[model samples]
Target: MKTPNMITKSLLLSAALATSAVLCANAQIKLNSKTVGAATKAVKAVTLSNEDVIEYTKEYIQWMDEHNPVAPADDEFAIRLKNLTANLQNYDGLNLNYKVYLVKDVNAFACADGSVRVCAGLMQAMSDNEVLGVIGHEIGHVKNTDSRDAFKSALMTSALKDGVSSQGGTAAALSDSQLGELGEQVANMSFSRKQESIADDYGYKFLKDNNINPWYMSMAFQRLLDLSGGASEGGFTKKLMSSHPDTQKRVDEMAKKATKDGFEKPTS
Candidate 1:
């Protein structure tokens, strides 16, 4: 009894529903494989001293400031982030610095030297508390020395790129140019699943320490899950989950932590 146009709409709706069902199924089973990331080639471990880490991190921060276009210090997002992170600065001899980049990518990161960079797109996508949760996770990385491992991984990878080998765990000092190249690599380095889990624990603890709603951790992950289209099927599957494992598991863990801390579940 339906007209031709009405029948066409019905078919489209049915097709969409079918696609959603398939995506849901795929999401459940997609992360079962142990190896998830695209980069698989192993790099031998290289050791860098704490002095080396500090110097290299400083240079890397300088290079980023010089090369990348950052949001103006007075810009709304920059100011907002500065204010939000104010309380986290100057604690335990760890002086944290915060900056906002005008990049379109929805990302935020922290370095071993306590430099935090937040992208404008990420701020636009996440709420204030969610942003705080992400910042806390990054701070956790620095606190747990995960950033040190990431830097070492990057240096090792760069050594391969430069055709250099280490001797007895004491490698040649990277040249300024090589260090710059290594810096770039370190900037993009992804932490292991264990490191991320530790960072998540730190984030939850940070929320509690600052009298913030611990549920923000769950809210942040849920926001990411939603932004990734509620399934591990597209860009989210390829990028975010590729580096970080088990998005849904992370969300569930955060929810459990929040509930354990006597916080209500985040609805959104």
Candidate 2:
């Protein structure tokens, strides 16, 4: 009973039990912890809350609909956009509520909480896959919390109130058009080219991860590049105004990454 073999076995069993207990402890840590909760939630908390973004965007769009000629598409567009975004985003642990405005501008943006707003003009300009690429780029912005950072920077640099509503900061008591100026000011916000690269990296990661054709994003950017020299068609102003890199070069880089990452096209 006192043999060395018996003692060795006992020690081995004890060590194995200890290791198992340690692992279980590690694995059982709360999924709701700061690092492990919903990925989108982290984006919101660190950058901007989705709820606030949605509320503000909704109110802003509603006002725009009333004051301007633009209106959001019928529910059908929302349904289609949401479906398309969900399919692509499922791979990244993110989702979105896509909205299309009947504006003539070629711009699209995503707010925190996956609120994606696209101009009808932008929608009409690209193929479905190309549009997915465009949306993926904006999703990169949302994931990177650019909207929050950009909005904050805009607010800091301006003397204007937060919005039309009496929400944040001192009131300038400006009229609706003046408030619109503030909105444009906020929207015109841009980050360094570094930020644009980061957004591109995120976009690439998303495309590669999701098994969507990674080249689509690149191709979409190429389209932007091709359109860059023209009269802008006015509707293309927003896309042109974005502080992104030369679309053609970005497209080439994305293609290279897609190849390096071994991205396989989704069958179907």
Candidate 3:
């Protein structure tokens, strides 16, 4: 009675109807509380105010200090950092605080909340002027609002999705696990080439303001390049140079700036 094509069309319609009915029946699947909370926090991260950023950054820095081995006042690393940063306590309206992390990693970072952590390994690898050069660069990120931007990006990740509070009055207290994840994200964060260049200019000016030669900027990068065996492909070297402009280019630029500014490159 029906043609073969009509029969086939009828069978296909029946299958489509069955699939739609199944989907409709399962459309009311429930989400657990954790899923709901994470979604809410993700939304909060997107809407975080400047005050919220500082509060959360404070909490993150506290967590970092608790987890890392901060050098005591009597420690050589602590004394050295204290001396080097004595004049930087109130830099550019920032009430900065400095601490040395007794870690083997040659790294340093500055937080938006005026927190700066320098690793002992970096100090060991660099002279006082070179270390100041590095610290100046870190501070430049804070002064340029680069740290705040980087922190916001870190908070946007799924790992830190549950890290912020959903409340409006204050930043939500993060758990140890959330704080740890946030720390990891911040540590691995990288800046754009433009941001890096701006920070470099800030560092150069910072040194000149402190009456120190800007040659150390080039020296610091040269030391890092040597430590990387001139390879930026992988390992700690990659992390140090992560998403940055070319290392040699940075070295050359700093050298040129120093020369133009009437600072001689130190030869030893």
For each candidate in the order shown, give its overall lDDT on alpha carbons: 0.57, 0.46, 0.66
Candidate 2 per-residue lDDT over residues 1-268, each given as its tens digit: 0111111100000000000000111122212222323443333333433444334434333333343333444465556566666665443555555556665555566554444556566676776676777666666665666655554333334443222222232221333443344355544355456656776777666665666677777767666666656232322333332454345566678777777777643332
Which structure among the candidates has the greatest TM-score?
A: 3
Residue 214, model 2: Cα distance from true site in angstroms: 0.5
Indicate which candidate wins on lDDT. 3
Candidate 2 lands at a TM-score of 0.62
**Model 3 — TM-score against the truth?**
0.82
Return the TM-score for each candidate structure: 0.72, 0.62, 0.82
| Residue-level lDDT tens digits of model 3 in 62-157 | 655655678999999999999999988989888888888786666677778888777787899999988888777777778777787677666677
Model 1 per-residue lDDT tens digits across residues 1-268: 0111111100000000000000111112111122222232122223446555555456445545544557787899988998898787864466877777676556666767777777677799998888888777777777777775566556556643343233344343334455344544543445567766887888888888888888998888778788877764432122234446568888899888788878886555
Q: Between which residue pairs do clashes occur in model 2?
A: 106-235
lDDT of 2: 0.46
Give RMSD to native, each candidate: 15.2, 21.6, 17.4
Q: What does the lDDT come to for candidate 3?
A: 0.66
Considering TM-score, where higher is better, how would the candidates rank from best to worst? 3, 1, 2
